[model samples]
Target: MSELLQFVFSGITVGAVYALVALGFTIIFNASGVVNFAQGEFVMLGGMITVFAHAAGLPLPLAALIAIVVTAAVGVALNRLAIEPARGAPVVSLIIITIGASIFIRGASQLIFDKQIHSFPAFSGDDPIHVLGATILMQSLWVIGGALAVFAGLWLFFTKTLLGRAVLATSNNRMAAQLVGINTKFVMTLSFALSAAIGAFGGVLVTPITLTAYDVGLALALKGFAAAMLGGMGNPKGALVGGLLLGLLEALTAGYLSSQYKDAAAFVIILAVLFFMPQGLFGRKSTDRV
Candidate 1:
């Protein structure tokens, strides 16, 4: 039981990061029918920038805040410079553009930040806290708490805010939204900004545990994309559940199977889930908007 509980704790921590990534995917997908593969780079930028900022004598909290803002600006630039120009292009082309952007960001990061793995002081001390005979790190709690808080906050935003309603309206029908005086272009920009900010926050929370480097974004992006797909492509609630579930399964796999196979094991299960339920756990019909 102790061993099982430990695995669950580990899974939840990493799963929280994946959930953040999935949420990023969900937001961009909702706004622009295209998957932003570059989302992981935003997370990478968050951690990298925070590390460098802290190293340069800025307080850790301030560093993290800067990372988030900078990454958000980068996201906005991506939309304006790359996506907006290709507005009427095929979705596949837009996706390919994002892939190109990911490569560009990775290369740029290597030049700008070097190739060193980096991390910062955890929000809480590294001492493990014991619960039910299992030990959990303080940072893990931060990750899980941060993810849940963001989820709840997003739920409230989508339900209550006028801008949020405009997002929903645009997602439902861009033409109709514009007819009703909604700024569809602004909605797309907001989506990218929000998505990038979430990704950066996840990087800030998880960097103490996982460390960070210029090249870490690809795997994170793939895993996050898997989580989103597993849950239901455009559903926020589904993204949250899928991310946590994926994390749990990955933990269990690493514990019972082998850590070497952990990634493969988790992905294989996701494949099975997708094969059986193409629309995912919370997905509605194809016609339904986020």
Candidate 2:
């Protein structure tokens, strides 16, 4: 039972990170209908920049602020430079462009940050708190808290803010929003920035526990993309549920089954869900309008 609880705790931590990443994906997908593969680079940049900044004598909070802001800017730039240029391109072209952007970012990170795995001190000390026979790092609380806060913030933004409503309007119908005087281009840029900020924030919160390197983004991207798909493409609620479910599934696999295949659990469940539901747990059913 202790072992199970331990796995559950670990899974929730990792899942929170995944949730953040998935939320990032949903934002971009909804606003632009493009899957920004570079989404994970925001996380990588967050961790890498924070480590270097902290090493250079900046306080952790300040370093994290810089990382988040810079990453969000990069996301805006990506939309302007790459995605915007390729607007109206084929889906395959768009996919390739985003994938290329991801590769470019990874290569750049390696050059700028070195290939070393890096981490910094957790916000709270390394004390482990026990609950229900499971010991969890204080850092895990940060990750979970950060995820919940971001989700709540996003919920409020979409449901309450005029700018967020503009985003939603753009997502529902770009032409209609544009007709109503909404600046669709600005909405796209905002989506990218918001998504990247969320991803970077996750990176900042989790890096102390996960440690990070340039190459880690690919795996994170894959898992986050899977989680987004599992929940329902373009659905914020789906992203949250999908991330938690994927994480819990991985934990159970590690604890009760084979640790070696624990990583496979996410992909396997993704396939299973796709096989049956296709649209995903919370995804709306769609039909082509002939």
Candidate 3:
């Protein structure tokens, strides 16, 4: 039982991070109808930027804030520079563009930050808290708390704010949204910015526990993408559920089976979910309009 509890605790921590990344994917897809494969790059930037900034004598909190803001700006720039110019292109083109952008960012990170793994001090002291005979690190709590906070904030923003409604309207139908006075372009830009900010924030929160390196983004992106797919690509609720489920499965697999196959666990689950329900857990089925 203690062993099981341990796995669950660890899984939830990692799952929270995955959930945040999945949320980023959902936001961008909903707004632009394009999957930003570069989503993980934002996370990489958050951790890498904060590491450098803090090393250069900035406070950790300030460095994190700057990282989130800078990543958000980069997201806006990505929309204007890459996605905007190629708007209305085939889905394959958009996918290739985002994948290319991610590769470019990874290369840049390797040059700027080098290939060494780096991490920072946790927000709280590195102490373990025991719950139900399972010990969890203080940083784990921070990550979980951060994820919940983000989810709550997003829920409020989407339900209670005018700008959020405009974004939703644009996602529903870009042409109709524009006709109704919503600036679809601005909505697109805002979606990218917000999505990037969320991804970066997750990186900042988890870096202390996971450590980080220039090349970590791809794996994170893949897992998050899988989580999004498992939950239903465009559904925020799906993203959250899928992420947590994937994490728990991985954890249990590693604990009971083999740690070496931890990564494969997620893919297995994805395959199983796809086989059983192609639309994902929360995804709504749709028919093409002929």
Candidate 4:
């Protein structure tokens, strides 16, 4: 039971990071109808930039703040330079574009930040807190708290704010939104910025635990994409549940089964879930009215 609790604790911590990644995916997908393969690059940029900044004598908090802002700007640039130009392209084209962008970012990061794995001090101390015979790190609490706060904040933004509604309107129908005087182009830009910011924040929070390098983004991106799919694409709530569930399952598998195949175990469960319910756990079915 103590061992089981330990796995659960670890799962929730990693799951929070996955949830953040899934949230990024859902935001971009809702806005542009395109899955951003480069979302993980934003995470990489966040951690890498913070590491560099902090190394250069800036405070850690300041470094993290700058990283989020810079990543957001990069996201905007990506939209303007790449996505906007190919506005009417096929989904395959967009996917290729994002993948290309991801590669570009990774290569750029390698040049800019080198290939070293880097981490910073935790927000609090490195001491572990005990819970029912299980130990949890202070940094893990920060990760989970960050995830919940982001979810809550986004929920409020979407439900209570005008600009948020405009974004939603644009997501529902870009043409109609434009007709209704919503700046859908701006909406798209905002979506990318917000998504990138979220991804960066996740990186900042988890770097202390996971340690990050230029090459870490690809695996994170894949896992995040999987979480989004498992939770029902384009749904924030689904992303949260899917991410946490994936983490828990992976931890359990690693604990009871084989650590080497833990990721494989998680994928198997995702495939099984998808097989029975194509729409995913929280996804709604849509049908056109005749």
How well does each candidate superpose onto the true structure, as a TM-score?
A: 0.97, 0.98, 0.98, 0.97
The TM-score that candidate 4 achieves is 0.97
Each candidate: RMSD: 1.8, 0.9, 0.8, 1.2
Query: Residue 41, candidate 3: how far off, in angstroms?
Result: 1.1
Give the clashing pairs for model 2.
none
Instruction: Assess each prediction's global lDDT (C-alpha) against the native.
Output: 0.93, 0.92, 0.93, 0.93
Poorest lDDT segment (10 consecutive residues) of candidate 3: 265-274
Q: Candidate 2: where are CA atoms >4 Å away?
A: none
Residue-level lDDT tens digits of model 3 in 35-100: 989999999999999999999999999999999999999999999999999999999999999999
Q: For residues 33-80, could you state the per-residue lDDT of candidate 4 as single tens digits?
A: 989999889888999999999999999999999999999999999999
Tell me model 4's lDDT, rounded to 2 decimals. 0.93
Which whole-number lDDT from 0 to 100 does residue 208 have in model 2? 97
Q: Which ten residues in a row have the lowest lDDT in candidate 4?
A: 265-274
| Tens digits of per-residue lDDT for model 2, 228-250 | 98999889999999998888888
What is the clash count for each candidate, in the order shown? 0, 0, 0, 0
Question: Considering summed lDDT, which 10 consecutive residues are worst modelled in model 1?
Answer: 265-274
